[model samples]
Target: MASYRGAPYIAEQLQSILKELGANDEVVIVDDASPDNTIEVIRSITDPRIRLIESPQNRGYVRSFEAAVAASRGEYIFLSDQDDVWIPGRVAAMVVALESARVVASNFEMLGGGPRPWIPRLLPAWDRKPIANLLGVMIGYRAYYGCGMAFRRDMVPVFTPIPSYVHESHDLWLAICGNLSRSITHLEKSTLLRRLHDSNETPAGFRSLGRIIAARVMLARLILEARRRLKR
Candidate 1:
């Protein structure tokens, strides 16, 4: 989990996630030099399975997530957000899907019963359609939230050292890696309850035409980079 000024709701989110984990399971949280008492709230949890890595400076959530994935010792790694609630059976379901695919992406519902986002939910039928999925990702049609995604340990090399130009949408980059490698699974059921608030990192509003065009260019470059890394 990557945290930044998430003190208000992280404790509840942590409780939701920790309950689903087994004795040997671990939760690695990389706080991106949060200004709030997020660290203190996490420390109050007092769980041996929880491992917190504090960043000396604010490096952004992308780097924080990269550090968390690198520090994780598990065979299967699941990405998480600091302020979301993990649904029951999320781990088992995603892990089961990951048994056959190198990466798995799942659906999510609104936490407080707000209206759903403009992006549609992912369907099981679209699981292995790499070309179509890549197109969906490029055009902002796919719902590939990092909090609802997981990948195998072997994908670290392919997904890491995230392109220096990628300042946002790190989750989409991971989805690109999975698709380019033709090793991604799309789960049908929702995995977590996403909390949408003003402080959320995800862009809730529309972008200008210039920003949209730039994002498309970035996605194109990301696709090429993924293919280069996986030699696809």
Candidate 2:
């Protein structure tokens, strides 16, 4: 989990995570030099499985994720947003999907109210099969919402060398890298209540057109790089 100035909802998010996860499960929370009392909120949790790492300085989302993954002990690592609430059975469903695949992505519902008109405008309905269809599906949107993704720890080495330029969308880079050897499983169940507040890092609605195009272009570049590495 990566957090910055998320004190308002961080405690609730941590509690929900603890409730859903088993004792054996480990939750690593990384504070990206948040100016708020996010650290104090996390300290009150009182769970041994919950580990807090304070960054000496602020690192952006990409580097924060890198730091978290480096410190985690689980064979499977689940990426979480500091404000979202993971519904019951979310982790179990993800575990099932990851059984045969390296990357498993679950769906999430937009909370803080019902859907907005721009929601559909931004995310159109499309078929999920043939996998190749994802190339285009991935163009204008995030294929695996970062908050809902799960991956094997073994795959981290392959994902680490990814350039920081693509750090903002590291989940997309992971999906593209594992696309060939491991099928990207999309779980139909809504595992998380994704909060869309003013501080969200992801672009929403028609305002994200530029980011969409840039992400697609980056995806193409990563695909080519993957191919080259395979040839070697």
> What is the number of backbone collisions in each predicted candidate, taken in the order shown?
0, 0
Q: How many clashes would you count in candidate 1?
A: 0
> What does candidate 1's lDDT look like per residue over 1-232, in tens digits?
9999999999999999998899999999999998889999999999999999999999989999999998999999999998899999999999999999999999998998877787888888887589999999988888699999999999999999899998889999999999888899999899999998899988778899999999999999999999998973
lDDT of 2 by residue, 36-132 (tens): 8989988988999998999989978778888898899999899999999989888888888788777776778777768732322112122234255
TM-score, model 1 to reference: 0.98
Worst 10 residues of 2 by lDDT: 118-127
The CA lDDT of each predicted structure is: 0.92, 0.75
